[model samples]
Structure formats: C-alpha cells, structure tokens
Target: MSINQIQDEIIDEFSLFSDWMEKYEYIIDLGKHLPLIDEQYKDEEHLIKGCQSRVWLHAGLEGDKVVFTADSDAVITKGIIALLVRVLSNQPAEEVAQSELYFIDKIGLKEHLSPTRSNGLVSMVKQMKLYGLALHAKS
Candidate 1:
C-alpha cells in the first residue's frame, strides 16, 4: 500500500482508542504484521549497536526507493522498529532524507520509551536516513 494509505490506517487505528494502553496494543499488533527478518541478517553488520535490545536493520535501494527489513529480539522493541520502518521506508532516497518523523510525536512514542530506548530509536532513524542519503548521492 502507499505511504499515505499506511498513515491513514495508523491514524484510524489510533483514533479508535481513548487509552494509551489500547493505542500501544494496536501498535504492537501492527508490528506483529511485519514479516520476520532472515536469520542470516542478524549478524554484526546488520546489528544496530548501542541499543539495549538487539535490533537489526538492513536497507537497500529498489529502483529509486529505499526498502528495509528489520527485527529486534525484544517484542516491544520490535514493534518500535516496525513503527520506524513504516514511517521511513519505501520512499525515494531524496524523500526519505527530507521526511520528518511526524508520526513519532503524533504517537507520543518518546514519552513511552525509556531514555536509552528513545536514544536508540533516534539512532535507528539516523542510520536509515544516512543510508538513504548515501544512495541519493550514489545515484
């Protein structure tokens, strides 16, 4: 589906909930929908260092867009990574580079995360954006 469609869906899901717990449960459900990453991709190169949980993200350019596959050993962390991928992945390199993570604030994610987890989430976003910028430069 298109990014707008994904955003609409997320908005719809969250809008239905009046409680933070329900909203988080929906986000976790969305994460469960993400396909599992390949075991081989869990190596050091793919690993996102400095995160409390083992989060791995692999990105590639498909035509003009950046595609990503990610996983985390912890369930809630995996959900967080899935949410990040949803907001950032599958866009043209230039678009990915320019995109602000509007959803992060809209979803109140930072308040929900511990300081370290929040920092790790920022690290993940920076890495993804860097990969997109590098691809834009190469192209």
Candidate 2:
C-alpha cells in the first residue's frame, strides 16, 4: 500500500480508541504483524543503536528497491519499529530516499513518546533511509 493509505489506516485505528492506552494497544498489535527474521540475522551487525530496546534491522538491495527486515526486544518499541518499516520497506531506493516520513506527524508519535524513544525512532528511520540511499548510489 502507498504511505498515504498507511497513514489513513493508522489515523482510523487511533481514532477508534479514546485514549493513549488503547492507542498503545493498537501499536503493539502493529508490531505483531512484522514478519519473523531468520535466527542468524539476529546479530550485532543488524542491531539498531540509540533505542532503549534492542532493535535489529537488516536491509538489502532487491533489484532496484531496498527490502528491510527488523525486530525489537520490547513489544511497544517493536511495534514502533514495525510501523516505520511498514511504510518504508520494499520500495525503490529513489522513492525511499526522496520520501518524507509523514506518518510521524499524522500519528502525533513524537508528542507521546519519551524524549529518548523519540530520538531513537528518528535514528532508526534515518538509518533505514540511509541504507536505501547508499544502495541507490551503488546501483
């Protein structure tokens, strides 16, 4: 789905819940949707820095696109990471490089997140996008 469609879906889901607690529950559910990675890929090379939780992200160039796989030890944080990957994964490097992350503002994510979590999320997104940019340059 397009990122706009993903944003619309997330807004709809969050709107159904009356408070942050339920919204958080939805986010956790989103994490559950992430695909499981191979046990071997769960290594330090894939690990994401800056997050309080242990997050592992792996990306590779597939044809002209970049595909990502990620996981996190914390459920809610995993969900947040999954949300980022959902909108960014499996897209062309150019699209990933040019894209603006609109979901963060639409979900009011930064406001609800702790300062550390917010910074970590930014780092995660930047890392994934940078991987795409580097792959684009190589190809």
- What TM-score would every model get versus the actual structure? 0.83, 0.83
- Model 2 TM-score? 0.83
lDDT of each: 0.73, 0.74
**Every model's Cα RMSD, please?**
2.5, 2.4
lDDT of 1 by residue, 1-139 (tens): 6555665666666677889898778767766777757788989988876546667888888998888788877666778788777866888888777666655566666653445554355667778888889989977
Candidate 2 error regions (>4 Å): 111-115
lDDT of 2 at 21: 87
The clash tally of candidate 2 reads 0
Top candidate, metric lDDT: 2
Please list the residue runs of candidate 1 whose C-alpha ends up more than 4 Å from where it truly belongs after superposition.
Answer: 1-9, 112-115
